[model samples]
Target: MTQQIQQAIAKLEETMRSIGVLDFSGEVQLLEWSKSTSRDGPKIKFMMQDDDSVLPFEVATVKKGKMAGQIYHVFAIRVDDLPIKTNESEIIALEPAAKQPNRLAQAMHTDGYFRNSKLWTGMEIAEAYSQLDHKSYVEKLPCCGTKFAKHIACNGDVVGHHVKTSANSGIRIKPPHWYLVPLCHNHHMTWAHGSHAGSATHEDRHDLLLPHAVALTANQMKVKAKKIMGISSLSEITIELLDAFEEEIFGEAGNKYEDFK
Candidate 1:
């Protein structure tokens, strides 16, 4: 295995430990490197194993340029291939959406709503803009921005980007709502997948970004609590409330946000 793949697996193991998916003794093993048929790029595959359990995953590696030799995407792969059971009659006699066009349209609309709910609304995202400006933040950083500096906007759609993309170890799950921070579209895209040619990518930089997201989200919650509860003073925003939010959003490892300024 290459040094980059080994390092990526080590970091993945650390994440598992933090989330209690694995104990300190648990280790991740690289299974193989295979070519992706569609993208024609090499994929590094690994699995987390302890005494009795093994969970497999694969990450796409950046193939060229400054970001080359870095793990780009890490995703879980279910090793078990349990056969799915289905009723043949029910499958063959499925109801057509054309029979209930209104219901189908309604379902589509509701799905859209659910999709949008994955991220905080633009208004909620704007709350953290004052305390933590993502534009200025990413502009000064090397991992997320450089060439796109000229195109970065001061006023545009700010998204509620999650610090932790997934809820569990390498599994694809949406993170809790409260783990989001206000980040501009440019920075968000840059970090996730480089937005422009020759732009920087995530490449182990989530460590630098996650803490900032946690801190800003906590502060934004405090401000929100002050406004909604009619608390006259920022000092009046109780620590208990922030603690509860952190525990709900950040799980067990959330940082102290009361003095995040």
Candidate 2:
């Protein structure tokens, strides 16, 4: 390892040393997939786990129970400050620019938490909130609103129900505002999940909400959104920058959607 990399490992080791210890928890540490790996490149792994929880353990494949794969170099979190220890002999504290993909220097919502399912990664839900219509999200829908409709006056009791979810309560990720609205749990669970009748569907919500979620995340108002989306030193986020990330991740679909637009 280069002197620079050794120094980074030393810093992270020091940080890990200082944090309080807890019961066994998972972590994402750096690895060298091959000797040719660049100094900036560290093979990230979700690390192994054995319990009711996984720091999103397993790996390959996708969906409900578990898939199998490793994770990589993301930063530490202020909350849930678990004891920091590593099994890996080599972990690098790359510069912020070279840290890892997504500038994931710090942990995002799903960085090291065990998820209930893998049918789809938490990644989709993490970004799903951004693809919604912010103005229509609140102004138009008092009770319920889909991509096509704006806020409709509540015919019944309404509360902020998150747009993204399935029947599985265990399956959830942080949602951005405009991603949530005044709707009963029935709408959040039953209606959107296709378990009931509504003009929009869970699938529709997923698809419709995605592009707008991409755009809408740029407008994350909630503190939770700010943390999960990694907004710091700013209140509002740039739609264009996030859009570019969407374009990079989603290709053309990241730009916009038809029914949603």
Candidate 3:
């Protein structure tokens, strides 16, 4: 590793120790540094061994620093202090950012914590759903299609349903928001959950909603790209950029629908 990165890692170690990060000991190992993207700045990954598992820390350079507009590394206190002798899971749970993929998931790929770093919490997905037009986004769900329209109108209680359960690994962790689709109570549970046998399965819902989810993500990326790149034409957005944005959601190739199932 370069001298500067080594220095940064040393400084991070010091910060963690001083902040009482609950048994922050052992060597601080570099995991991976996710390259900078239009939507997000660069992220640095490090881990401190605890026992059988290690505690990971994902840090990013300050976009706006007080030092003459220079973007530099600073150990900004995310929380007042971590609980002493806290377990790895609890320590991770304490970190709000640790739950999402943006930085944590990006770092996780190298450590096998997650295959995809573009997952979202249920609340985040719900917020996105809230911002969209009900008719276009929610009403268009496979469950709400013309075929099902006669059987059951949307009932106006749309909720975000995760396309893959394995993405979370368990019920405790929230699924990524990108792999979510809006579905009413009946579709989400009654049909999708297999309560109504032979009805639309989760896979069916995923197939129907995948295109819409991709389009929504692409549109969001375009907006961010335009602002960051200062471009107007939609055609200016490159496929590589779009792919990167998709990676931010779906993660690497193994995270696709087929792999998830």
- Tell me, by TM-score, which candidate is best: 3
Number of the top lDDT candidate: 3
Ranking by lDDT: 3, 1, 2
Q: Of models 1 and 2, which has the larger TM-score?
A: 1
Residue 149, model 2: lDDT of 33
lDDT values of the candidates? Answer: 0.39, 0.36, 0.41
Q: Point out the higher-scoring one by lDDT: 1 or 3.
A: 3
- The candidates, ranked best first by TM-score, are 3, 1, 2
- Whichever of 1 and 2 has more lDDT, that candidate is 1
Give candidate 3 misplaced runs (Cα > 4 Å): 1-151, 237-261
- Residues 29-110 of candidate 2 have per-residue lDDT tens digits of 3333444355434433433212212311211112223322222354553222234348765444322223222322122222
Segments of candidate 1 deviating more than 4 angstroms: 1-157, 165-169, 195-205, 227-230, 234-261
Model 2 TM-score, all chains together? 0.24
- What's each prediction's TM-score? 0.27, 0.24, 0.33
Per-residue CA lDDT of candidate 1, range 1-261, in tens? 466766776687667644533322223444556666884666655443321122111111233443344332445432233332375312121121232223322332344321232223332444522324433332322332222233443244556655564441255765554444444566666643466664434633355445444443443333343334444233233445434533443343233343422
lDDT of 1: 0.39
